[model samples]
Target: GTLVEEVKGRRFAVSGSGFWQVHPASATTLVDAVLAGADVRPGDRVLDLYAGAGLFSAFLAEACAPGELVSVEGNRRASADAGENLADRPNAAVVHAPVERALRRGALGARADVVVLDPPRTGAKEAVAAIAALEPRRIVYVACDPAALARDLATFGRLGYGLESLRGFALFPMTHHVECVAVLARA
Candidate 1:
């Protein structure tokens, strides 16, 4: 099924498959948080990890006009959908590969200005190691689980990155689930 999500008055039609929730408020929070945390600049390269429907890809590509934006996703359908959703952005590219494998193969490029990863509830331990290797200037991580976020922050510490800021949102609206976005920069 196709669902419409409007973030900051910008509309995006996203596929509802792919084992993730296409919640509008969550999308807005993530997009806003990433932009605030990354402080993207023109001509900066950006990497979107676990880019389900290319939401952040569109956001980053438009913000950093003419800059390079590459989004990596493991699911085939979601990748295709992202490709279509991000079609208008000439600076964006969607790779249909898992983040770990893509990083191992050097597909997402090296040392981007910003890297945004919206990992699943289990967290992105394996992917963070690879993301840290990218040495991106800023890392905007969107996590659904606090424990996972904490653990990844620890890994980033070991890699010489320090958490710049963290913001929590009541994305689940009264549930125990909270969505958090953490920003990390080189210390």
Candidate 2:
């Protein structure tokens, strides 16, 4: 990873670590999926889980005013970098902790209006439950693995979240890996 990279015209430090490594096209696809049917209000609070370096948080910042978004990541370095990336965003705070622990620990309360999560290839099982606990109106999940996405979707279902839209992207090209973005709404 490069020390600094640009996404959607926003530049940030990657720290030579590929935490949020993904093709630019894939990134665009994921962001597009999240923004497609998103109903973000100006004063709505947003929870960004697995918010490596505040990628999607930038979007939230644009939609909501300052102090309306909380971005959580497990990696310390990535979280630190997120601090800098989201520095200009006074309202978007980065919490350096795992998504599950952060939510389970009550890092983010039930005040979130929307939640955007871009978990790793393993997907987020417990984290999904935690997000469900928040009872946000909408949830946008960016999944790198189909199997994990399926399992987590079931968990969301059990938690009373309904899958509204799902889109797949062949981001890796010839590789078997496909990125899927799913938007879920509370039922």
Candidate 3:
């Protein structure tokens, strides 16, 4: 089954039990945060790693018209949904592979102007070096775990990426869970 969610006037098709943000307001909040931090320019190449059902990729694709937006996801169902969700955008493509493997195999291309990633609670420790290797101008990281985010941020720092700005959101309400969107830039 497919579930279509409308966020900030954009429709996203999520298939099966794919990873859609748990919070009702999460999609819009994260999209706004990422777009502001990305500062994407026209014709700029963008990469959306760990993309789930093309949530952020759809918006980025519009912002970087005539450029390219490569969305990579490990989950089979989610990737399929992403492809369908972004079908209207000719400049957008969805790759079904783990973020680490895709980056290692150069599946995303040689360079990216901006990179937006929403890794799981464990974060993207394994893909930090490879992502930094792309030398993107800006990296917008959406993290669900503070500990994992800190560890990954430290790794990014050593790779010449400095934390430019970070915003935290209490999307979980009563729970202690907090979502943090951190933007990093090559130094």
Candidate 4:
């Protein structure tokens, strides 16, 4: 089964039981947040980590057309869907690998102008250093856990990436769960 979500006029094909924003408004909200925070320019090389089903990859690829976009995901099913979802964009490459390994291996590229990090609840502790090593000018991180986000931010701070801004969304109305988008810039 598949579920298709339309965000800001763009349609994304998501696998059933795969990760998709649970809140009805979350997909749109997060997409808007990420695009604004990224501030990607035309031909700016970009990387989308943990790019489930090519959600952000599609938009990023369009923004960076003729530049490059490497969307890396560890989930086999999700990566397959991402390949299909991003098929229309020749500038985007969907890689089925762990984000950490991809970054560590320099498989994606040597550098990126903008990087979008949407790691799981555990945060991207394992990949933070590797990502920073890419020396991206900006990083937009979408985090679902505050503690993990804080820890990763601290790690990023040590890696010369400073938090430029942050926005929080209460997607889960009655629950403690909240989604946060933090923008970081190289310092």
Candidate 5:
């Protein structure tokens, strides 16, 4: 695993290693996703599922100024780095646990105004289900895998959420890997 680095001018901290190595484009894509679809407001609660190194969590904390921003990460090293990265944010909470376990425990409480998910290539089935169950006002999904994104979007659609918009970013210029952002809202 490579060392985590903080993105300048943003509260996010991202790892330099992983299945999708953190590069300038990938980091920018994540920030762009948050900026385009967060729909955050003061006093709102935000959830960052599959929050690696506090990237989305930090962004939400800064952009939303919400009542709280809960970040969940399954990897130990990533979680530890997330804790260190988000330590300065008073409204942020970094939980070192699987997204599913955190959601199952109701760690996010009854409601969240905004939910952001940046899961792995496999997508986030259980996390998506939990978000649906919580019925957040807005959902921002960042995916590196289009197929998984489509599958998860179908599930969200079945749960009464419609895809509002979609955007693509060329994170890996030389490779087929790309970053996609999707906004979903209740129908």
Candidate 6:
């Protein structure tokens, strides 16, 4: 697969074997998630936790025109790829670190408006706490496992973030796997 694609008038640069192993949510799913829960707009500052090759970061940058779009990843390869993918976007900042450390280091200050978390099957508990402390206007969570999503949702509730909306995408046509996106707002 190619590293670049023009989807709906926006250019997305993806790295990592240039393969389709990680199928980012389809165009429809992306649009639906944003429409359902994102409270982003021009000039908002955003954070993409567990950013892979910067897929969501690129989309957020295009949609929100955020003052800053920070992409954080711990894997060296993924971090390098994310940096490459977002290199052209002046508003995008790629941080090579674990999500918990990045958030704890005050990478997300008190002024961020939007935060996106697309963690692995094992969700991010510490990172979630950091995000809650920031009190962003909105938080978008993407998860591949329902159990993890539920657990994280419970954590969010304890931290005063209400579940605003949720949408699921069948990225895998016939498997038991499902991808979910949830929007959360400060309660």
Q: Positional deviation of 154 in candidate 5, in angstroms?
A: 0.5
Worst 10 residues of 1 by lDDT: 16-25
Q: Give the TM-score of candidate 5.
A: 0.90
Please report how far candidate 1 places residue 148 from its true position, in Å. 1.0
TM-score of each: 0.93, 0.93, 0.97, 0.97, 0.90, 0.86
Name the better of 5 and 6 by lDDT: 5
lDDT of 5 by residue, 1-187 (tens): 4654546475444455533344755675667667679788888888888887877677688776748888888998788778988898899988888988888998768788889998989999777788899889999998889999999999999999999999988867798887889999999
Tens-place lDDT per residue, model 6, 1-187, is 4376545565655553532334554754664575457667889888888877777777777666747888888887777877877777888888888989877888656667888888888898677778888888999998889998998899989999999888888888878998888999989
Residue pairs clashing, model 3: none
Question: For residues 1-187, could you state the per-residue lDDT of candidate 3 as single tens digits?
Answer: 8787899987888875877778788889889999999999999999999998998999999999999999999999989999999999999999999999999998888889999999999999889999898899999999999999999999999999999998999998899988999999999
Candidate 4, clashing residue pairs? none
Candidate closer to the true structure by lDDT (higher is better), 1 or 3: 3
In angstroms, the error of model 5 at 4 is 5.3
Cα lDDT, all candidates:
0.85, 0.82, 0.92, 0.92, 0.81, 0.78
lDDT tens digits, residues 1-187, model 4? 9988888887888889798888777988898899999999989999999999988999889988888999999999999999999999999999999998888888988888999999999999989998898899999999999899999999999999999998999999999998999999999
The residue ranges of model 5 lying beyond 4 angstroms of the native Cα positions read 1-4, 10-21
* Alpha-carbon deviation at 3 in model 4, angstroms: 1.5
Clashes of each: 0, 2, 0, 0, 0, 0
